[model samples]
Target: MPSSDKTPFSRRALLAGAAGLAATSVGVASWQQLRQPKARVLQARCDSYDANLVGILLEGMAAFPAMLAKARGGHVVLKPNLVEVHPDRPINTDPRFIAAAAAAFLEVGAARVTVAEGAGHTRDAEFLLERTGLDELLRPMGVPFVDLNLDEAVDVRPPANLTRLGKLPVARTVMSADLLVSMPKLKTHHWAGVTLSMKNLFGTVPGHVFGWPKNPLHWAGIPNSITDLWSAIRPSFAIVDGIVGMEGDGPIMGTAVPMGVLLMGEDLPALDAQATRLMKLRPEGVEYLRQALELGATVSKHRIELLGDVITPRPFDVIESFHRLRA
Candidate 1:
């Protein structure tokens, strides 16, 4: 991971460069040009990692296939938050959710469901997979896992110039996917505030090309990198694992908090906004979330109707110092 302080680059310089790209990327045009998306309800299930949990989760996500018309009859990609493993803290997105999502997608008519992720922090993707227990969880489902880092690369340009980044080299598998399901763990992040579906898109950029943790983007600014990458990939849908979330010092080192809930939505910003509030933080306070709303019509600001076991997230054990770091 690149240090925020001594980042081999300067934020001032990056923003200056982004200013020039902004004119071409996310044009200074009318908001009507970027037609806002409709609000959709995604059902979430609160379940632990148990045998019966997958079945219950599948039932909760039953509406997804029909909800995302594009997903049906297309190749789907399940991107779980497999950052790094920890026996004590629930840092990564639970594999149970990934398994359940894969099963649900296949049930709804997805031609093929491939489980893929580029472990940004870890050099060896296989070790990360095995330690995270995703290997065991995906095997029975016969879901194949592909290391996005080693996969072929392709250049992509987002229609929305939401960030300073220009053409990005994303994993070929991710570029060609008909549907991208951002399966991310709900956790607090020092730089991005809270990393949900949008932040999770960082893994889609092959580390082999960009460097572990994708430092080039970090040099560009974590918030800027996220918005740029998200617009480029634009995941079709999302499932956030809040069942067990990390807080305090997170995304890796943080105490586990049992929020005991799962959140789903096609509008990731709404989902991320809801997740941010669930963490007791404001959505507008987070740079990327605000940018997400800016790109759309604050679709999440209107509130996404929550379905299935709707409950307020348990107060997470967030870092006290960051509590005042709200944007």
Candidate 2:
């Protein structure tokens, strides 16, 4: 069922309640198992989207046999960053990359592969898909696209409840997926420091319940809301599109940087941390990453194991205020 509460909840009330419950609600120790000394992250260098992306993705996916085994005969949902459509800017994940990912998963024996996104910026999903060329690429492949913004919702109490919203109304399609894949475009953000895998989960928050652009989450707090969402959704894997990334004042309105790489891993935090470093930024300077580390998410280089290409660090431009995040 969809959320019945149409009115937005008060941010003050939610924060106050969360402050009281956080001590007991957040279980840091339970996430300890994920804090490995070396979490495997595959970093494949693909010069452009036109390259053999499917072959590269399949090779990377093969590295994690356990995840593939689990994906076998299971429903797989690809949550790509479909923020908005812009002709000149690299605002959304490249549609070619999304199609390649879908093809790779189907080849690996996924019972079903669905492309899903609850775009925060726009309500017209069809127009976004059409404009971004995603509809054209996905249609011939028989891959169904779910507009998560309009999907049925279920109230879920986040294990961490860091935002004190008590329960989040998550899209039913994402909640029921056998395996959820977060496919985010690597980018710098005006808020949240950097938007990577974990931040990409923001699309799962049904716009029907949270309103367009998810204002309630922003009102509560972007960082806290991100961590809380991670605790609730716990996506199965991540594939970050970094072949062409955004820099400076982003999420939108940034210039593109052709970093020429694709990152894949089961550990979202570790993968994001590695991506942050590749951008020549410090993950610890990012609030959500710091909070994630506190909750036992791995961010340190010593904790991540890299495979594939050895690309040199490239500094991505950022707004004046975010200068401190530069490494």
Candidate 3:
């Protein structure tokens, strides 16, 4: 685990440099151009966790050659949703799926892949990892796991400070990654409607700075914080674990709904919009997603080009407060 220097990097400078590198290496004018008019969102039917996820993921990645080219020889950091461990509830992203994602990225030429997360519900990352089976699954593969909660912190201002919080303290592991891939579980959040890739970024904020459960961001506002975080971090891509999702009063305390599908795209907002639709909920009902559109995030259904398996929309049960979110 190499450490990131204490020096802060501006969001604009970091994104500009990344965009330039991508354009030079892949012959794309910019990430914006590559995703404009319509962003390609791949949906694959992964019937079970037993399925060959790596091959399915590779096939999905093949659809976006330029994205793969950009990832070649780069260090990739996978940020998965890991709130806590529950015996019966599906509260976290499945470790097997994370392993499969790491394998897929390596197959596509990523120099290295590291799994990192700052558990909001618990500071016991070692216990959480052991209980969730991530340690056992990833250690054998030599994939290092970083507890962002304890990692060195760096203060970076978001391009758009939607939350009005001046500088956000982020973990060094996240800031130094050549590519950041958000791997969120497809679950309903009691506060945010659906907790997809954008909301999953809550784990990136160091608990050491923000306190357990990252209360400051939540108090500032979940939706605004989500938007601000995305603006600052600009994750390179998102791969949603929808094979098994939680519905009804979630992010915790929900029933599992086996969606049996995986969704992927560079446009996080759009990808989340599509996932919202898959949950048979209205994307507009998700506040941050709506804000993302108002702030120029693309990928409306009219603008999203779907690739791979065609999945029929399934209705997910939401709590009383979120009934309006149902399509």
lDDT scores in order: 0.77, 0.91, 0.90
Q: What lDDT would candidate 2 get against the real structure?
A: 0.91
Return the TM-score for candidate 3, rounded to 2 decimals.
0.88
Tens-digit per-residue lDDT, 1-327, candidate 3: 334445366678799999988778776434433554577799999979989999999999888777787679999999999998887988899999999999999888899999999999999999999999999999988899999999999888977788889889999999999889999999998999999999999999999999998999988899999998998898989999999999998989999999999999988998999999999999978899878876778646867888889999999889899899999
> Between which residue pairs do clashes occur in model 2?
none
Tens digits of per-residue lDDT for model 1, 1-327 = 557877755889898888878866656443433455655545455657664655665666666655457678889998888887777889888877788888878877778899999988988888887887888988988889999988888988866655456678889998888988888998998677788999998888888799887888888788777777887777778888888888878878888887777778777777787777777777777888667766663444344666676576556655675675343
The alpha-carbon deviation from the true structure for residue 251 of candidate 2, after best TM-score superposition, in angstroms, is 0.9
Ranking by lDDT: 2, 3, 1
lDDT of 2 by residue, 223-255 (tens): 999898987898889999999999998988999
Worst 10 residues of 1 by lDDT: 28-37
TM-score of 2: 0.89
Model 1 / residue 207 / CA error / Å: 0.9
lDDT of 2 at 275: 96
Deviation (Å) of 327 in candidate 2: 0.5
